[model samples]
Target chain A: MPRSAHRRPAAGRLRGARGLAGWLFVLPALAFYAVFVLRPIALTLQYSLYDWDGIGPSTWVGAANYGKVFTDPDLFDSLVNAFKLIVFFSAIPVVLGLAIAATIRRIAASRLALVARTVLFLPQVIPLVAAGIAWSWLLASTGVINQLLSLVGLGGVTRAWLGDFATALPAVGMIGAWVLLGLCTLLLLAGMSKIDPALYEAARLDGAGPWREFVSITVPSLRQEIAVCVTVTVIAALASFDIIYIATQGGPGNTTMVPGLQIFYLAFSEREVGTASALAVVLMVLVIACALPIQWFAKDGNK
Target chain B: MARRVRPGRSGAALVIAMGTLAAACAAPGSNSPQPQATGTSAVSKAPACGSAPITMNGYFETGFPLPKALTTEFTKQHPNVTWNVREDQFAVITQNAPRVLADNPPDLMRLPQVSELVKDNLLKNLDGYATAFGWDKWPASQLEQLRLGPGGRPRGEGSLYALGLNMSMTGVFYNKKLAAQIGMTTPPATLAELDEVLAKAKNAGITPIVQFNGGATGGLAFPLQSLMAAYGPTGPINDWIFQKPGATIDTPSNQQAVQHLEKWIKAGYFQKDVNAVDYATMMSRFIDGQGLIMFNGDWESGNLDKQMPGNVGFTLMPPAQQGGKRAAMSAPLAFGIAANAKNADCAAFFLNWVATDKRAREIGVEIGGSRPMGPADAYMPEVAADKVTASTLEAGADIAKDNGAMDFIANATGAIYAKSWTPNLQKLVAGKQTAQGLLTAVQADYARQLEGN
Candidate 1:
């Protein structure tokens, strides 16, 4: 009995040493996360509670900055603009990605399919700032787009895409779509490739059309990828800055103002660091609120 | 697939962390203000720079190229001094000010946010240097623009924190060929005459005014300020800019000025899609003779002289009525010494030399692409080649003599242009709002900004 008890302690010690080794493996990353991520977020949270001009002494205003975030119409408008961007950044990309992925999947082993995928994915590799500048030039009133429209005798329908009050937000959102479509398509294609070909083959043998095969087999397999695409694109859309900054700078009467740009302007330009921090915290909460559900839905797809 | 998802998860985690760090680090209060070490360099003494191996780190705005000759001459005089200069777009300078000034500050930096920098105590007070260097002899109007009150509040009569490298004025630039086509022989002498000229230009199928309202380049704001200067009291306008406790931009004359711009918009005097054009586009359009006139600053004078020499004419925005005092918006390409500068003496020497040195003034006019700080008579030889640049210099000189100059309205606050003026002017041009509505919105924003103080 004494021997068994002593053996139990020895086994426990071995397990404990193994556990310590496991913890040591994770220590570096955890330290990095604590220092870089957690500390900054905590500092941001603390700053949001004050009225800081980014210089001099800061006054602790205590929740007033949060109140400002909730009550300010401009802040709410920025939030609404972000949500509106999701329609372009997430919805349109996923829908178009599915179509592209399905079409390309049929000829996946062909050279033309490879070329098309490469061409479509070109935008993802380009820097967002360069892409923004190119699009701004293309969409300028006297730019090539209008020149083409005039060639087609449709110049009257064209306006400054990024500089008109009514079209600026949608125009910026469309840029987001253009950037995300390729990435989404590639991801969905990866997911579609992993799906058992027998499922589509069976659907086809049962007299299902191509559309039906896509809707049932292709889409069902791509749920996780769609979730991934939605999560990433939604995050990009909400936190968009460089593209919009280079494009319109939220101009034409602040039509394209998003939370990211507003937070930057408030903090850097206006010196209202406190209000900016509050907006930033609110944005993080929003990103979390948005990303968690998509992740959960993505995890559910595995079942 | 797990590999791909793992990278993404880690990427997002880093982004979340980085986003917060970016904000936290940019906050100026993240670090306590370092104790200021004042330099004991007195300009009263003759050139005393020895073989001290003085190193200077300077940051200049992209558009304003630091005069190579100025640095070369300084180096030639002080053979041991070495300069490490960096140039960036003004936006980058403004965005990184907090970080740059908080850590190792450059010896000299272009003051984009003067008020904020002063408030943070990131700038050195130049009173001693100014006194010793005879910078006090410069025009009071010019010197007053650099003066700051306690905590670096702007437009106050206190210790000067910066000095202008050269004068920059915003006025009307007309295409000579287009002006002749419209039967306008000379630049408009009055606001009414300007309107008539615009009408003639429009009838002749030329775009009248090439103004960029898409971004904050003071496209429409300059002309509006000029009109307001014509009718409004200079005291009140200066007070408003100086941020006197009771100052307001909602004066009757100011309202009339904005209303006048609205009328021009209604009359189609500005280019089609005025709000759509940016600064570069408008400048290109005007230079290409697509428009009869451009409302812009003297920064483009060098380019104008280069691109279409003898084709462009320059003049101040004419008075609201005939025989009114000539006025325009004029400030300087201002630079300030950093409080934490290791070589404050070298920085102050540069500022003083730019303002007073003969070769420096010549380079300031010709190579530096800026009007000299001294009167036009000081460097007439340098601008003798470019008529448009000469005309801009003359306009600035006249405005200084008449004491009719005022700072840009956007200068009232760092955020005024981006948050209020540009957007409101765009709204007005789009016909979505009236002049009074614009004033109300701007005043409300201004008050809110002040309340934050």
Candidate 2:
């Protein structure tokens, strides 16, 4: 007992030294995070309470900017548009990704599968801005899309997809879907690889069809992956800026005005730093509100 | 359990660090000096470049080749002076100006909208440099747009805060071949004549006007503003743009102008897919003879001349009536020195040299395709009569002679262009907005922004 008690003190000392070394190793990253992320967040919170133009003296107008975020129709409408984007940015990608992943799983050993995987994932590799520009050209009134439509005798319905009031937002959302589909598919495919073949074989022995096996085993196994995809894509939809900025720029009569672009216009274009900061805070809260539920639901599903 | 404990500990640490940072740094703009009106006499005389080498830092708009050519020439002329220049898109410059002026304070920067920067005390008062270099002796209209009254109100009537690199004017550029096809020899001198030309061009199956209305550029505003000038006096328009008290763009005359523009839109004078066309596309379509005319500025003259030499013609927007005075959106390519610029003297010297030097004036004409701002009788660069640039320059002179120059309405506020005018114009193109609604909405937005400021 005396030897054991003596050893415990040495072990405690050793643990203390290791902890200090570990902290030292991570100190640089911690400092960077504090400066870049934490500091900016704190500053944004502080700035949200003021009426400042980013330059000039600021006035303390506590919560007025936040009030504007909710009360202003333009601002509120932007939030709604962001929510609408989730269907394309999150839901469509996830469903389509699952289907693609399931199909690829059957032909996983073939060379064509490799090519399919690479082709499907190409959108994920392109920069968002380049993707935006390319998509904008393809969607223009006289662009390749219209050319193809005309060839197929669909020319009468052809219009400027990005410049139309009814189609601008959906067109932008479709671009989002295209960019995220690749990422979601690759994630789901990776999840599908880990599923036990035995489970599928057992389903087959039970007279289950391909659809039933997919629904019963593959989906249950991918709960966490789907949740991850939902969380990431939902965040992308809510915080989307680059593609919208390069493509529509919240134009065609503000039909595609998302909160991300709205905040940029407020702070940078309008010089309304206070309102921009307030909108940013609200967006962050909304993202957290969205992501936390998915995470909790995923954890519950796991149990 | 250990991992959970670590995250909690880290969260507390982050809070502590953030609190420390919040305390360490003062609120942004808290320490900034309250903007006070500086007297004209408070400016200091610009010193000559001495033997010591000076490397002036400049922030310029990207894609404009004139600034680069000018800087290179300046360096060659004065071996002791060199340039370290950075370039960005104009929109990016508008966003970055405040920070750049506050932190880095470039010696020279392309000032797109100077009123806000001036009100923030980020721009240097150039009255003394103007006096020293006799810029005051130049045409009053030349420096009018660059001046701002106290607190940046009534922009054309106070201390000079910036100088023009060159004077740029916007007008109608027509495809000569297309115009001939429509049997138009001389440029239209009246609105009725212009309509006749447009209808003739349309009947001949040529696009009348190729004005872009896509994305963020809103090239439609160019024609809209020109129409505004055609139907009314420019005083109220300029007043509204300069944020003059009681000024409104929703005046009766301007409404008439908008109605005229709507008539053109309804008459199919523009391309069917005009809303989808961007500035580049519009320019390309115009160059390819897809359109008979394009509402653009002299900035395209140099390029257009090179692309379709002797195939394009420039003219002012015709007046509402025969022989009536005409106006154009004529403004300077304004550049200013930062309030805290280290090489203010050298920057001022370079600006002066750009205007007065013979080689500089020639470069300004050949490359910039804009009139160099100097004394009314200053040496003017001669160009071939057939070049599109010459016609544009001649139009600029006519604008100056009539004292009919006005600022682009897009420069009224930093956000007005993108947030208000652009969307409203897009809505107009989409048939979702009316002319009256467009003006009212824009005025309301302008008033709200002014109130916020």
Candidate 3:
């Protein structure tokens, strides 16, 4: 007991030194967070309670801006539009990713396989703005897509896909799908590579077909990767700006107006900074609300 | 290089293009003037930038050419003074204005739009400088257009907040070869005649209009405003645009103008999938000789002169009735001194020189592709070097002489174009809505904005 008591001070000093070093290491990141992240968020929160025209001195409007976010039909419509994108950005990509990953797992490791894998992952490396521009050109009325269609004797179906009210939102969503599909497939394929080859062999001995093995082994093993893809794609769907801004700009009669674009227009063009900030806050809350359940499913689905 | 479909605006290349685009939403004035409110006059010489190690900060868009010339002259006059200029996208400047004005601001700012800046008191009132420089000698109509009431409310009768280096005019730009093919030997004398020309061009299997509505709606609004000015009573149109008391945009004449646009769209005069085509594509295709006519402002005159010199001709949209007033849309590329400008005097000095100096006026016309607002005799002969410039100047002179100039309707509110007009116009063109429906929607937005003010 006497020896332990004597050793306690020395141990306490060592522990204190380690604690100080840990804080020292984290101080730079903490400072950055306070200034760049927390500070801006704090300022935005304050601005959300006002009726400022961005340039003019702000008038205190309390919770009026927040109230508007809830009551304005356009804001609600914008939120709904953002959610609709998740079908294209998250659900379809993850499903198609699984299928592609399963199919690629069976292919021999030849040069053709390498080339296919590289092509599948290519979209992830390109800048999103460039991708959007490419897509816009492809989808334009007289663009290459229509030229191809006309060549195949399907010219009657050709239309301005991005500019038509009926197709604009879906057209834009499909661009998101095309961009995200590559990422999802690559991630799932990486996960599939990590699965034990012995498991598939054992399943085959149990009279399991390829589909059964895939459903039982591949799907269950990729639970975490699927979650990650879903979370990332969902956030992207909600917070998308560059692609939409460059491609459609929430136009063709506001059929594609998402919260992110709406916030940009309100803050910059309309000078309604207060409302823009309010919408931003609402969007943040929505992303969290939408993401939490998907994360939960990813974490618990295998069990 | 052809224009690009820039996310916000085409920026520097479209500086003059956007200049006219916002003129509608940025009505210089709407309210009745306060009786006997006139700036006092005092003739003054060029401001001296005293020899000191001074750095004047400035912000401008790409196409504005005055900064280099002004800086060079200023530095030459005062060797110790230097200009530090920052060129940015128009959208960036506009979006960052409030924060920029509140924080560290430049000495000079090419204001995106006036009403909001004036309301926010982000600009230094230029009346004192106007009085000091004997600017009262300038035409009252030109100066009055710069005035705005307190908080930027009721434009046109308060204090001057900005100064324009030069003005721009909106009109029809025709492909001369296409026009000849369509039997339009001369410019149409009236809107009805122009309609006939469009039909003839369509019958000839040539696209009559080359328009781009994907990125911005200003392309659509140009012809719409011209049509309104041609058929509608000038007073109500101007008053509605300026946001005058009891003004309303849902007038019968405005409805008729919308219907005419609808008719044009229905007659297949415009390109198929115009809403999908971007500004750059439209200009490139037009340069490629794909269209007979395009409604645009003179800001593109320089580009037209450079790209397809002899192939294009310019003319203002004619009035609906023969011998009726031939009104056109015209406005200036305006700049204002920041309220917190460190070198307010230096900025004011530049504005003074740009407005009153003959050398500056010559530069404004000959090189800048700008239309002159002063006397006809004041125009530079050097402008004749560019055919587009010569024709635009001629049209400007006619409009100025007859007082047939009007501001853009969108200038009534900053949100009018993006929030209201753009979507409605797209819907109208798509055949999903009526002309009256479009006007009603736009009027509601305008009223809602006014209520907020």
Winner on DockQ (2 vs 3): 2
Stretches off by above 4 angstroms in model 2 are: A1-13, B1-16, B33-37, B40-46
Docking class of 2: medium
Higher-TM-score candidate among 2 and 3?
Answer: 2
Please state the error at residue B137 of candidate 1 in Å. Answer: 2.8
What would the per-residue lDDT of candidate 1 be over residues B274-314, giving only the tens digit for each residue?
Answer: 77788888878887889988888888887788899899989
TM-score of each: 0.91, 0.96, 0.90
Which candidate gets the maximum TM-score versus the true structure?
2
- Tens-digit lDDT track of model 2 for B128-154: 889888999999988999999887887
Candidate 1 lDDT score at position A122:
94
Model 1: native contacts recovered, as a fraction: 0.45
Write candidate 3's Cα lDDT for B297-383 as tens digits.
887887888889888999989999998888788777778887777887778877777766677776677666666444334546466
**Greater-DockQ candidate between 1 and 3:** 3
RMSD to the true structure for each prediction, in A, is: 5.3, 2.9, 10.1
